[model samples]
Target: MTGSIQRVALITGASRGLGRSSALKLAENGVDVVLTYKDNADAARTTTTEIKALGRQAVALRLDMADTGSFAAFAAQLKSTLAGTWQRDRFDYLVNNAGTGAQVPFAETTEAQFDQLAAVHLKGTFFLTQALLPLIADGGRIVNTSSGLARFSLPGYAAYAAMKGGIEVLTRYMARELAPRGIRVNTIAPGAIETDFGGGLVRDNAQVNAHIADATALGRVGLPDDVGGAVAALLSDDNQWITGQRIEVSGGMML
Candidate 1:
């Protein structure tokens, strides 16, 4: 481990969707990966298997982003995993991408539902970073997943978008604070993608797909890998100069 100069990234919510895609991309690019899943251990292990096929080190841990109390223990276990699996002390990148999306109208949005969104999206990001900041290497990178809904007002997503907007601002503050340590912070705001987000409506409903496709200037909904590649690129050493910015990967939607 002394002479190994490879970078390692810890991606939360890496069990599926965009996080899984990002993990695969980073692994393919020779970056070591530490990915986490909330529940689906089987799916997460499949991702790790694929990463190992890429010939890079990969490990998966159980993580629940909504449970803030477990973060310290989570961080400790992650550190142990890193030390045991990769023989490394500090990881090079941190992608705060774990979140839950809900589609509820403003009036009907219950206090419990709104709190759930705030807890996972806003509070989780804020506190999780605080907990894991020690393990992130100097001059590292942080990518917070935001949403295009934060830019354009979208109905039934008022609370979710608001929390994402908070992350946009938080990204700027993180960039400023971590810049001194050479750790760049940024947000990737993706448009509609074929993920299980919001009950997999886009993937299941042709009408939903049509509406999204018509809205998208690319004439198609985004793939998970679209946001994933953008994330991997943002964390790359190639993107050293860009920080504190929210880059939208929306396939030109809402233009």
Candidate 2:
């Protein structure tokens, strides 16, 4: 096992939003990071620079979660990166945080939309994790991103939330299967936040934001910090005993 000071994490979709925040939070705690971005190389570079400024090693790579065919190549590239950069064979943590949002009502949701959600949120996560398993050290950690919509009903989010629900179930299965290797797998189901996800509905629309705030016990919509901090804490060694659980960082929504 790598020493705590040398621990590294691979966070997907980390160019911005929760992933970016999580990467920074981890770096704040001395964890090196390799982050992935879908399209924005500039944003990814900025994240790496910030991590480097924090005195932690950082690398940014491109990854499209919806494309499973590219996972093998990504995994290969990751292996080379680990050797060339960190001189290590495996990383200590994996944050499967890359994702897209869908808001079509169940009745209006098309099969294409459903498939895209499944590909990005479920299939891609499953296979990418599988492909990267050999490079994840024993006693490592995995955090799969979920959504509060999976636990509570929210119209127009049926398809999106369903995929997250599947992820929650998958987390448990991964925890069970990977137990012998000492890998802990868990899910983080975040409440609506003010990110660019889902066309920024919750962030841009005052009525929607207010409605969410009223429903939440915290009386405010969540921010990237709300979730990124929780995820950072969860992946810390202090919470090693926790696995196969769904930790919702929703400020007590629907309670």
Candidate 3:
């Protein structure tokens, strides 16, 4: 077992949004980070710099969440990178956070759109985790990003929410299977967060934002830190005894 005194976490989609915030939060909590970006090199480098500024080791790698065929190669690259960068062969945490969101009215949702979502949210996560399972430490954490929409169906998001729902169920299976090794898995379903998701829907549409806010007991939409902090908590040692569960981090939304 390759164990570092300070653990490591690999957060995908870390160039921006919740991923970026989660990288910083995890680094602040003393976890070295391996971050991945899909198509934003400069943004990824900026995040690396920020993580280094926090006095933690950080590496930014390009990872296409839709590329299921390349996952085996990615796992190999990840192993080499982990050995070279951190002198460790296994990482202690994995955050399956790379995903896309769209609001196409179901009646017009295209096959390409559905396939894209499936690739990123379902197949990519499933295979990547499977490929990397050998490199995960005992008592490790796996955090999947689900969405509040899975619980409260909004028009135009049926497929998107459905895949997230799949991930939520997948989390349970992973937790159950990995329990013998002491690995914990859970999902974080965030509410209406103000990210670049869906062309800035929450930031631009006051009515839509307010509707989500009114639906949430917190009386406001979520920021990236809201989800990031929740993820950090789940990854922390303080979160022992919590797994195989879908945590609703939407601040009492729609209940």
Candidate 4:
């Protein structure tokens, strides 16, 4: 997929979980990485070490998805990091993977909770990408993270899924507007992945895990690597023509 020309990817919230997996997969695919962590500096360092051990350069930065006011500064820091680390002004891939999770029933949902979700998942992604537009190389790829809940109904995920639904729509508009630069934008929706997300309900809870497995066509919940591999594949040169789409890495979940 990738030729001799080295590529670089920037993934937010990559200290652990799906973001960490995606960073490692891209490194394995010969792409250098710049990852961000909100508060877990130790985890971010460990991920960077892993990527470096793979013979690829990696860097970790601090980022908070809920702080849109800080995006301009973050972009400036990123610009400096790129210039110092790679001696370049642009990076080849951007994975908008930073977000928080909430699991409150709609009936109990609070205004603060909804605002926080929107701030991080919807508004944050939209403005962060806008701020970083100049630093993204022409013909680059952007994969915005969505969730399977956006398509399927789930009780406590009304707020979370709503933000992801907004992301799916934003992806199409991004693809259309960025087409002139030959950039590709798309969404990757993971279904019931066994991560620490949602307080590890899917990963640590037996009943929840069993229920997901029963509903999934593949008979199991998805792992982080399943989505990491998908991210690397989608950003590869082979998928140059595929953009403005929603690809679920859920092992054929829910039919």
| TM-scores of the candidates in the order shown | 0.97, 0.98, 0.97, 0.98
- Candidate 1, residues 59-152, lDDT tens digits: the string is 9999888899999999999889889987877898999988888999998999999999999999999999999999998888999999999999
Q: Candidate 2: which stretches are off by over 4 Å? A: 2-5
Task: Go through the candidates in order and give the C-alpha RMSD of each one to the true structure.
Answer: 1.5, 0.9, 1.4, 1.2
lDDT per residue as tens, model 3, 1-255: 233377899999999999999999999998899999999999999999999999999998889989888888888999999999888799999999999988999999999999999999998899989989999998899999999999998899988998999999999999999999999999999888999888889978989899989988979999999988989999998888999999988888889
Residues 101-188 of candidate 4 have per-residue lDDT tens digits of 9998999999999999999999999999999999999989999999999999888889999999999999999999999999999999
Count of backbone collisions within predicted model 1: 1
Worst 10 residues of 1 by lDDT: 1-10
Clash count, one per candidate: 1, 0, 0, 0
Indicate the residue-level lDDT of 222 in model 2. 98
- Cα-based lDDT at residue 152, candidate 4: 92
Q: What is candidate 2's lDDT per residue for 218-245, written digit by digit as tens?
A: 8999999889899899988888799999
Lowest summed lDDT across 10 adjacent residues in model 3 is found at 1-10
What overall lDDT goes with each candidate model? 0.91, 0.94, 0.91, 0.95
Candidate 3: how many backbone clashes? 0
Would you give me the overall lDDT of model 1?
0.91
Better of 2 and 3 by lDDT: 2
